[model samples]
Target: MSVAELKERHMAATETLNSLRERLKERRLQLLDTDVAGYARAQGKTAVALGPMDLVCCRILQGHTGKVYSLDWTPEKNRIVSASQDGRLIVWNALTSQKTHAIKLPCAWVMTCAFSPTGQSVACGGLDSICSIFNLSSPLDKDGNIPVSRTLTGHKGYVSACQYLPDDDSRLITASGDQTCVLWDISTGLRASVFGGEFQSGHTADVLSVSINGANSRVFVSGSCDGTARLWDMRVASRAVRTFHGHDGDVNSVRFFPDGNRFGSGSDDGTCRLFDIRTGHQLQVYPHPQDNSTPTVTSIAFSVSGRLLFAGYSNGDCFVWDTLLAEVVLNLGSLQNSHEGRVSCLGLSADGSALCTGSYDTSLKIWAFGGHRTVI
Candidate 1:
């Protein structure tokens, strides 16, 4: 080999290293920054557009065989868990972009999977009507393990979402198509309180989504097929703290601002509405560009600073909006790396530095957040 060529290569390598070192010096979370590895191509697709000015695809992790219905990155962003219609729960090592384990469940078409606040456990729910928790501390977890720590049995219908309460690591809340949301004491392994009646009136149809207030352990908001979103302050345990009406169609999702003064809802009517918690009055409504003709807004999340809103649409797109001015800062149209179907779910980490998206196309995509995004 020529010495000049070798010297040139050596110089190139050193330059790349120096550039990366400068970039890493400014990392926000001390996170393991790894680019995603899978480009899920379609049968006859020539090109994919993931938005130009904004929403660049940093990485794509593809492993699910069926529609990747739900996925979430653990608090530390080191591990990710995804559920698919193939009746499998797959956990991945987010850093190396490798599959860690495949958890086989009783049936196919699972809906959601969530990690505990401590990242020590995981819970999954689906069409099977039962929620199961897996302990990550077991030896099996790191070796492609499939251990069911406990099967939480109770719901009469599909369990949509199960999440650990923020203040308590041992407490969980599960919402179901059975028209109810149940709170369970994780340590005691018993139902703590049912929001359906004991604490608040149950929805007439399916309870589609549920979210807890970041500042209050006893407060939460639930959306239902009945076209209403209700705030349940279990601190009272007798009735809803407030009931709100605005959406003309079924409310598909609900999420609270970090401060707990307001909340947001996504509805089938193709609008994401923000409302005042104290007055039960609509504070703002971000509707579809097509004016009710666009796809449904499936999920909505707030930036840790509570100034930005990220909304996922059924038309296979995502939009980043400003909370204060109600303006879309970026309309990340159809992901260049899209699912064969719709993007069913997306989650931003607690600090708002990472975004995890899952879709019927059977894939998960993660995006890095900027500056933890506090109050705009």
Candidate 2:
């Protein structure tokens, strides 16, 4: 074809794409049921302001030579297990900042880790595409190394996240780059159920995070690169129970609210959103201020009362949001002695008395309401 004709065709195609994009945007706006922030404002609602004095960093746990990727608190809330790029999983006493066990991993690219419900074992997975478990009570070898108790294998891609079923250490759930979530039988080291795959109604991209419902063991939510979060039931692995969408970028993390009736998600789009499971509707959006560069949210958690939402960002900021009013209560990252690098992960204690944040700074800081003994 002549250059003139080719140019004309290219311009026509570009115009068509732009028109369709605008139409999609308009459709989304029309489907939104409510503007949550607007409703709150009309009702004269305001969040109780939280300051730096209300949340203080009480302990800094330093030992890892590499960035901390993931962490989980024991059911008792006194202990924590952290996985780092250093190829080691370190179990620490949260109150004392002492390492009780440091097991060298078989794979150095470990991306995620979790503590079993009984606190008797821990599991980790990474580029190896296998979930390896280590029994805390088992005796170490002559070299003082903890041996792998079991390995769950079958994933075709890297395991991105994992969590043990509440009150049941025998079963665990994991999200993977394979675009699926799997429930594993820990004892048999076999797949108990697979939630999504190429032939199933599941995530269309890599699943990055999973949060099992604290109120319902059989139910869980997974965040994916497809810009959606899906609710899945362990008993019905054929399809997701519901899919929630709103994010314009990858959904990086998902966490169940304290009540489990609702869940929150953090995304590469620089927004943290709350969704209701029953109605499959977005309830609120906590957007990062556009003037601040809008760093991607890497992880998120909720206070015990479900009133506060803590979101960690890629630029080393951890903003604590008041869930009801949809406002920033405090920025933990801006406090004294906060993480010096990107906040990679954060988790609230089982009792919600403290919050532990892991960062690319190779350290984890435990923040209590006021001091080490203060409870929020």
Off by over 4 Å in 2: 1-33, 371-376
Q: Could you tell me every candidate's TM-score relative to the true structure? A: 0.80, 0.91
Quote model 1's TM-score: 0.80
How many backbone clashes does every candidate have?
Answer: 5, 0
lDDT of 2 by residue, 194-300 (tens): 98896457998999999999899889999999999999988889999998878999999999998889999999999999999997878899999866668999999
Candidate 2 collision pairs: none
Worst 10 residues of 2 by lDDT: 367-376
Candidate 1 lDDT over 1-376, as tens digits, reads 9999999999999999878855754442233232111111223322222234245556678888888877776878688888998888888886676887778776686888888878878888988888888887766646455677777887888998887897467888988998888888777677878777333366777888888887786789999998889888766556667777768888987988888988999999989988778755676778778754689988888878776788888888788876665667766555465445577888876556667778887888876633433223
Which parts of model 1 have CA positions greater than 4 angstroms off?
1-54, 139-145, 197-200, 334-340, 369-376
